[model samples]
Target: MIATRKLRRARVLIAGCGDVGLRCVPLLAHRAAAPRVIALSSQPARAAELRAAGTTPLIGNLDERRSLRRLAGLASTVLHLAPPQKNGDDDSRTRALIAALSAQRRSVARGATSAVARQRAWRGWFRATFKSSMRAGVKMHAKAIKRPSIVPDRVPGTAARPRQIRLIYASTSGVYGDCGGAWIDETRPVRPDNARAKRRVSAERQLRGATQRGLLSASIVRIPGIYAGNRLPLARLQKGTPALAPAEDVYTNHIHADDLAAILVLAIRRARPQRVVHASDDSDLRMGDYFDLVADAFGLPRAPRVSREQAETQLEPMMLSFMRESRRLQNTRLRDEMRYALRYPSIHDFLRDFLRDFRSEANAQFTITSVPVESPAE
Candidate 1:
């Protein structure tokens, strides 16, 4: 109960409070002792939505260093879901945030030192020390006489220890580039092939750099394709885009949206200092096969299959960028080290529930809209 109360008093901040961050709010808020939740939003228009969902939203832009000044010493736990600015190799935003946090830590350190010095220099210091010594002696005497010794949880001044903010950053698995469909773990060296993936690498480096300087403890979660009922490629499938043929197909990974949110919260709470883990599920389907499965579930026609050579012409460059990689990620660290059991262990399991809810909602909407209006008191 005491632990729960302590957690309730904690402040957690979510940067880039989009779909995933919003989903995480209830998981923390509905606990026996709810913690304070704050979300960062670049758009002021979203403040009302954030507040409605029980999170206090702070408007700030990552690109503008001046805007991030307000985030100093704001929360003890931070989920950094914001992406790097486009068209840049370096993530200046993350660097700016780290600088702000370092400044806050230094300020707190100075204050703590001053407080200790003032206490030692006080006119009543000797008297207070004598009283404290006497009280300890009396407690020891009482324990020696009639009770087993019990150690105190913490010393008094220790309670005023400087706060340490922990950060959990969301990165992309594309940093691995093409792995020839081989099974790779977090230990594998990153070899990003494109600028988009390179940007993620830059962000990862920034956080690790901050970790090295004792600015913060951070965890990096490398993610693959993220899908939910609403986030799926249903529209692309409907557009009749061509996927690679089975013989030429590339393997891909995925994580359900809710599972990703759960992983983020888990990382925030349980991540080791400077740890990196993959946020991928157990599904090991080829890219084309995965699309076919979803299309079948939705009763839509499957995407047309073409050889890689043919697909180059039919598919957009952005879509082709995804197909160029074929790597299976090993998530042993996520399971063994962090001990996070995936709620949606596979894409199939997620699709089943997602399709069920989607159909039900569609049916309800159709029923409401299609109902005929009757004449009033005819």
Candidate 2:
């Protein structure tokens, strides 16, 4: 009887409950049904923080497979916000997460407690306690709530729904690589140039194949630069990190973190199967101009600009790698299909409003005029 209820609850599991994932928790309850939110954390230390944020914390490491068995059949809707590990061309973390989520129900059968003795002495007891605790909560969430599907009225793929677990993956727009500053959509073929993007491509491929095989219904959301009041270019400006000059600056894309959190919530049901949507805003600005906007807003000095040639010698490899790629994303699908109206439509729009609280009217005017930006409409 308890096992049966487990199948019903655990409605939404947020794999990576970091800043963006934390932002997603309340929105999930607000926009959709108030399904229980379970957060998966590798560190047990974060259990308190996760609980404080109104999510039931389930300790499971994506790097380790055994710890994830409890996650099997735990959530009907999964928000995969976990990123790939650093220094890899493939996302082993995603691979493990998929394996665990798709694992057989019987893999974690009762009376498995004794099995822990076979592992290394130091870590064995911990793994044993972890899995046993998950078993203790096998009754799942108290009672299943009435679900409200996030279907868009005008979207074509509403009908013919497949009965499978829903997985909404937060993929990066870097998968498209450099488009020579062209206005591109989802139809553009992916040409991942960096190891970072290659991992994302691998994740996309795995999700699409999973959907095809009916393992799970996956929705891929391609996101660009995510910024919020807390997440800004303040550090770079303070460090005086150089940006490319106007002549050599590459076009950049952005989506406010709050807006992104909202988009993820909407994509839970509105997004089509194996579909990709850009969570980008209509901010048509160069990299340097963007720095200037933030600098002016907070009354900070703008970062020094260097030409592309000079940047290679001055900037770190990571910064230079970002400078190499230049493309503008089209978010028509996000607006039309998901029907999500942006709360912060553009970086400029957000900065303009932010300036109100940041500085005086006289200073705000100076900030707006300080940065010269090109018109970019997504």
Candidate 3:
């Protein structure tokens, strides 16, 4: 029974346990008093993979509310990396997740109420017994319980309670829309211009609302372009995809995959309630120049440059959408607030190391699968 209780009291739960969520598993698993890591996966096939990564696989889909019911009281720390459904402006997935986690509130309230009621009854009995002793001409001295029936379980610096689970949300920087290559901070209000970014905005709003209502203690990490040793633009470079000309190119931010995983772990320790952070590196590179950097590092030919109007015709609408949005993100909170030291502080740092390994074929097992843009939240 003790073992069963320990297993049920898993402390960390990861939703959308894909590449990034999988990356977070070991970081939590190898701690001093390591917490049991539970990862939610829609795919049954990935259960073995999740277990191999030192996490307990919980088969649950964010889209299906019934499957998520068991999530109540299952974890105190939640890493919500699951994304919105591909089709709508609203994030139904996050809504379902919130509903499932919020289910804990009623049961916890009932428990607290029962405890308070018992304490009150015990106090009344003690006071009456003392009065009877005094009337019987016998001296008795017993101290009254202090501060009973009013215990506070609030989170530090916020009104959130222990009944509410703590969560870290992986949000996208694209929620800011087209910034005209301007330098922006977390303080900048979001003005999403497309359906994809609009969904992200809706998710953020829902999380913030949940926090306000004391359902969960949420921290939003507004991530920019994420690159790794294997997640480079090698395919796009090899495919000869046209990049925008220097005059038309826009600024983009980046963070290495390893660095991002570390940041997510740190947020659990250092992030405040309802805080927003940008998980971006320090480099400021234009879209064309970034492609050129990858091409040059990999010893590949640079693709031809095209005007924005020409790109409209040449590139797909998805690619064009990424091309339209441009902003330089400042990760001040990620540094000062989270106190995180990035492994790859800039893309150049990762590229320099990666190029050496590629030239030597140090890890011949390394493979690159094509993904179009630098994945932010999704």
Candidate 4:
């Protein structure tokens, strides 16, 4: 279990509690102040794990207004790791939460009866306030929530007090979208040519706007490919999946999931809002080199290489396009500004460490399962 300091203790809410969220849960729960930790996930099974870990788990839709409002009231800090919504409107959920907070602030400003009465009324009106605020937020984004499958209907109440909150939105380095082998940093100009990259760029801007508007102390961490125990790409390679080899020219960056999580917690403690950080290891290896490492780790056959022309002809259009660009990410900002360091600083280091553990586990399981069964005595 990771220990936490008293200073870092604050009511923290983790939205979109997937693998990453679950990994962070123990860290938050171990705080010295024992800050109230709330986790929300649409999947009951996912929430159940958090509940077992002594967290208050709520099954709620990230896209629904009321769910976000309830979440905002309980948490002084929010971490967003949910998948982007369909269409171009990825900020809808965050906007809804902000609107709910604004309404609560307004209610407080208007002196809604007595403080005790207001608190009681806010508690009672939470569900309704969430619905209205969400609608208003969707409108601001020029999106009709009704068309989406995840959007919820309005529920009829007063907003709660708008408490101070900090937001850490996980983003992707794919925003750079292959910088043609050029080294890039937080200061690098983003020229996102692909649709996914373009959307990520837009999302980053929206997050910055929230910071500017004082909605929350916000920061963005543009992460690269993340791998860890169960989620590692090695497992897929071990299963005999053919690794795609695009042009050897397209370089890729990667970070261990543990390192990424640690950086997130570090950023929270540092409180450097409106900052953009790249969460990547020091090495930038080619895509083929990455797959080769995976193949070696799993004792699998080496991936066949193809000429650029053949690759373009045989691979999917999207895959070919992805292979066309190469970018090297520099994490100087994370090191100098955030004063952070990666535990797994190179792909080779990460692969070696992971494979060692994996092989040990495999050996142990084999030994356990290979024990000879005793013949039944007649």
Candidate 5:
């Protein structure tokens, strides 16, 4: 009975409940008639935090299909925030998830059909046999309640009206690979240069394939560099790392973490089915310019600029990999399809607001000291 009751209420399943997923929980939970929210967490320690965030924590790993069985036919909507498994070119986890949802959808269709047919037959018999008697009883109850009451409405969907599950996948903008400072849109062909970007491409392909198969209405939000006050590259800047010269540098993109979270929610609620949109802010600064801006804002010396040849030897390979990609994402589709206006429209705006509080805290720490006060009447 409890399971039946749970099934009747709308539920949203978050397959990956990390930083952004945690943010999305409250967005759904605080609605007027909120749906039940569930989050899958690999670590049992986070169960309490997930619960506190108003989500029922499902302890499961995306890699283990057996662990995910509880999620089948469970939610009307799913937010697949999990990334592709490490050490793989293809995403087997996504494949498993799609299969599970497909199986459950089919099962629900059959069950709903059977249940609806049985309900109609039972209703017909009850009306024919107990019409007069039920009328009198209903009249008496109406008098007491001051209004006539009929049987409660049936559960929302039937076989004829199967629920359509929707998915919003977060992808990486690296799929466009080294655009040579051109403006790339969703229609741009993906040219992933590394294994990491390849893996993201594979995940996007799987979701797109699922959409084509009519298993789910899916939207892909290809994100670029995500930054916020807490997630900035302050540590790298403080390390005195050198950036590529402007002539050799790549044009980079950025979206504040909060704006990315908002876009994810919007994609789930408003994005067109099978659509791909860039979730980037209006900042179109070069790699060195971005570092310089942040350094200037934080009152740190700007990183020295090095030629491409010198940077290869001086910078770490991971940093070099980022410097190789150059593209400004066109966010027309995001605005048109998702109807989203980014809260942090650019890096300068976000940093200015963040540094205001950051500088205050820094100043307070520098001036304040803890000292023991003597007890007057010990």
Candidate 6:
């Protein structure tokens, strides 16, 4: 059985409380210890919902040093889920947070005149340190940041933690490039053939660097196509988005967002090593076949097909590239190491559940529409 003691009721700091982070909240909330979840988002509406869900949601910029200090002080483990920054802004934010936390520690370590005075002094120092960090963070994250080739230098005046905090950085499978129908596992060498894939490879290196330096207990989770409920591709087809079958036999993987979140939480609880974990359901369904399944689920027509030559010419460069890659991602590590089993293991299961919910919602809408109008007659 998966041990829950380490994570139960543990204070958690979640940055970028968007779709994934929000989904993780309810799962963590239901744990035995019922953790004191602290969510940080720049959006007010999102922060409000987090608050409603019994989590302490802070609405502020993550780039601010003060916010980082306050958050670091409150939680031992931090989940960084900010959008992928293409200009190294993410690195700056990480640097700032570490620096601010380091400063707070130094201030605390400085000798205090008296026990009571020291307590007061420490509190005052924390407030001032947080304020300064927040100011710096705001400037650093003001724009879209790109991933750098090498890990950036640590911020000055910040001390490294005796034992670094744990972090899980969400990544993408696009880093694998076109595997050409081969099976890929963690041990497979990365051969990124495109600009986007190259960038992801570089970003993964930076994450590994943090681990090597003993600055962070970091791991990378490479997620494939993720879908759930209304977010599934079938829903898009039902809503009349054009579904076309690619001419090439490109194989891809997918996982439910809920499952992905669960795996992450489980990994954290297990303190599973600083390593890479693929968050795919282990499905190697072809793109064309997958589309056919979606169509069947939604009772829509089979997607129109195009010749290989036509597909190459008609599709966008990015879309065409995706259809050309054919790789079966191995999930044996997740199964054996993490001992994690997917909740939705195949496209069939995903479509079945997704369609059931879709039909129920559609039926309710139809019933509301068909309700008889009460006449105001006599």
Q: Compose the digit string of candidate 1's lDDT tens values, residues 128-177.
A: 55567687874333233332133232233433445677999988888888
lDDT of 4 by residue, 119-190 (tens): 554445654555777778743332432333331222123333465568887877767666778888888878
Task: After superposing candidate 6 on the true structure, give the runs of residues whose Cα lies further than 4 Å from its correct spot.
Answer: 1-9, 62-69, 86-163, 234-247, 356-378
Better of 3 and 5 by TM-score: 3
Quote model 5's TM-score.
Answer: 0.80
List pairs with backbone clashes in candidate 4. Answer: 181-326
- Indicate whether candidate 1 or candidate 4 has the larger lDDT: 1
**Residue lDDT tens for model 5, 1-378:** 988876677888888887778778878876666789999888999999999988999998878888888877778788888877777688787888888777766665454444455466445545554566575674433233321143322323433435778888888888888989999899999998887778888888888888887678889888888776656566667778888887888888888778888888778778888888898888878988988887888777888899999999997776788888889999998888778988889988888777687777855432221111100000
lDDT tens readout by residue for model 2, 1-378: 968765555479999888889999998777534778999999999999999998999999988889998987777889999888776788888888888876642232221212242223224444555567668874333233322243222222112222367999999888888888899999999998888888888888988887776668899999888777666778778778888888888988899888998988889879999899999998777788889988887778998988888998997776777788899999999989999899898887898877666665454332122211211111
- Candidate 3 segments whose C-alpha is farther than 4 A from its true place: 1-10, 110-163, 361-363
TM per candidate comes to: 0.81, 0.78, 0.86, 0.74, 0.80, 0.71
Q: Model 5: how large is the Cα RMSD against the reference?
A: 11.1
Cα lDDT of candidate 4 equals 0.65
lDDT of 4 at 200: 63
lDDT of each: 0.77, 0.77, 0.84, 0.65, 0.76, 0.63
Superior candidate under TM-score, 3 versus 6: 3
Point out the worst 10-residue segment of candidate 6 by lDDT: 369-378
Q: Write the per-residue lDDT of candidate 6 for residues 1-378, one digit (tens) a residue.
A: 246664444687777676677788888777877667788777777756888866798766656666555654556566666644345323454455445434544443344323454555545655566667677774333233433343322222333333356777666677777878788897777776665556556656766776665455677777777666545444334444332455456777777778988877776766354688887886768777776786787577765677666677665566666665678888887898888878899878877776677677755532111100100000
RMSD of each: 10.0, 13.7, 5.2, 14.4, 11.1, 14.9
Weakest 10 consecutive residues of candidate 2 by summed lDDT = 369-378
Give model 1 RMSD, 1 decimal. Answer: 10.0
